[model samples]
Target chain A: AQSVTQLDSHVSVSEGTPVLLRCNYSSSYSPSLFWYVQHPNKGLQLLLKYTSAATLVKGINGFEAEFKKSETSFHLTKPSAHMSDAAEYFCVVSDRAGGSQGNLIFGKGTKLSVKP
Target chain B: EPEVTQTPSHQVTQMGQEVILRCVPISNHLYFYWYRQILGQKVEFLVSFYNNEISEKSEIFDDQFSVERPDGSNFTLKIRSTKLEDSAMYFCASSLWGTSQETQYFGPGTRLLVL
Candidate 1:
């Protein structure tokens, strides 16, 4: 089974400060991880994905995540908090090794709040 | 950029009534999917469709749920009986391929409120 756990239910950061959202995953096989963001009343937008190729994945809007196999973690980060960055962030994992249809298993999500 | 689109941004329905949620995937995409998020809950995969049939479905996708690509461009999900617990934000997504490496683009989603 593939599952992801988002460590924080909510996080708040001041504008221009750094931001971090923690996620840990459990997978029986090698997993593909992704970070997606959803703004109020908007659909989820893919931030980045980690296949086997890259450890540090860059995503849209100055967001990035690092895949650490030993830690079983893929934590999303940003250098500076922007007002538009406030949204719900989901950590997802897919079990490509199972050869099953790629259905994503998601975490409960972390709600980010940017303070001015 | 081409993106997936869903209709009826908001819908309120009585219990036991049927509801059909519609989506138009990216023109060239071959795989389509449906997911939903209950209030404050994780987004869950309901079903995946390809080759005009269901390729995979989660436990939540029961007999009450059915999917159809009746036309070349439209994909629809019909719920035979609405339940109060069914209230959630339903999202439609599409990918060029059905691989883990493929990125699934999502739509704005339809907020379904079952009364």
Candidate 2:
């Protein structure tokens, strides 16, 4: 079974410091990975996606994630943290074995807290 | 920029009552999906619709749940009989194609509270 696991349940970072949120996935075949962020009471916003084209994928809001197949990881990182970067982040894996869209397996989200 | 839109930002209803969550996906998109997230839990897939029919659905989407693309533009999810466990945020999403590789844009979810 394909699954996603967010290593951190909560991460606190001081403003202007670096940020890192770890995620790992298990898939039987090639995986399409994604990172999504959700602000309080808001819909999910696509942060970045790795669809086999690139190992390093950059997303909006100065966030980026690297797909490490050997490690089975897609961890999100940012050089500097902003107060606005505080939100719940989810790591998702899509089943691509079939041509049709499959249900997204989501990680237990990690909440980021930025302290000024 | 076109995005998926859902209605009734929050809804409160009694248990056993019927509730319909409405969504209008990106006009040109052909595939639609419904996902739900319980409070403080991961998002779970409910069902997927394409070509005016259900293409796939998860076990959580039991007989109590049904999806319809009644017209060309609107997609709806109806719960026949709501239960207390049904309280959660329901999200509607769409993609240009029904491929796992395609990005599916999500809408502001409808928070359903079954009391």
Using lDDT as the measure, which candidate wins?
Answer: 2
Instruction: Give the poorly placed runs of model 1, Cα more than 4 Å off.
Output: A98-100
- For residues B40-96, could you state the per-residue lDDT of candidate 2 as single tens digits? 898999999889899999999999999999888899999999999999999999988
TM-score of chain B of each: 0.99, 0.98
Model 1 chain A poorest 10 in a row by lDDT = A95-104
Instruction: Score candidate 2 by lDDT.
Output: 0.92
**Candidate 1 lDDT, B1-115, residue by residue in tens:** 7878999999999999999999999999999999999988889999999999999998999999999999999999999999999999999999887888667889999999999
Error of 2 at B40 (Å): 2.1
Best candidate per DockQ, number? 2
Per-residue alpha-carbon lDDT of candidate 1 for residues A1-116, written as tens digits (9 for 90 to 100): 78999999999999999999999999888888889998998888899998877799999999999999999999999999999999999999985653445878889999999999
Would you estimate the TM-scores of all the predictions? 0.97, 0.97
Residue-pair clashes per prediction, in order, are 0, 0
RMSD in Å for candidate 2, one decimal? 1.0
Q: What TM-score, to 2 decimals, does candidate 1 have?
A: 0.97
Q: Which stretches of candidate 2 lie over 4 Å from their true place?
A: none
Error of 1 at A15 (Å): 0.4
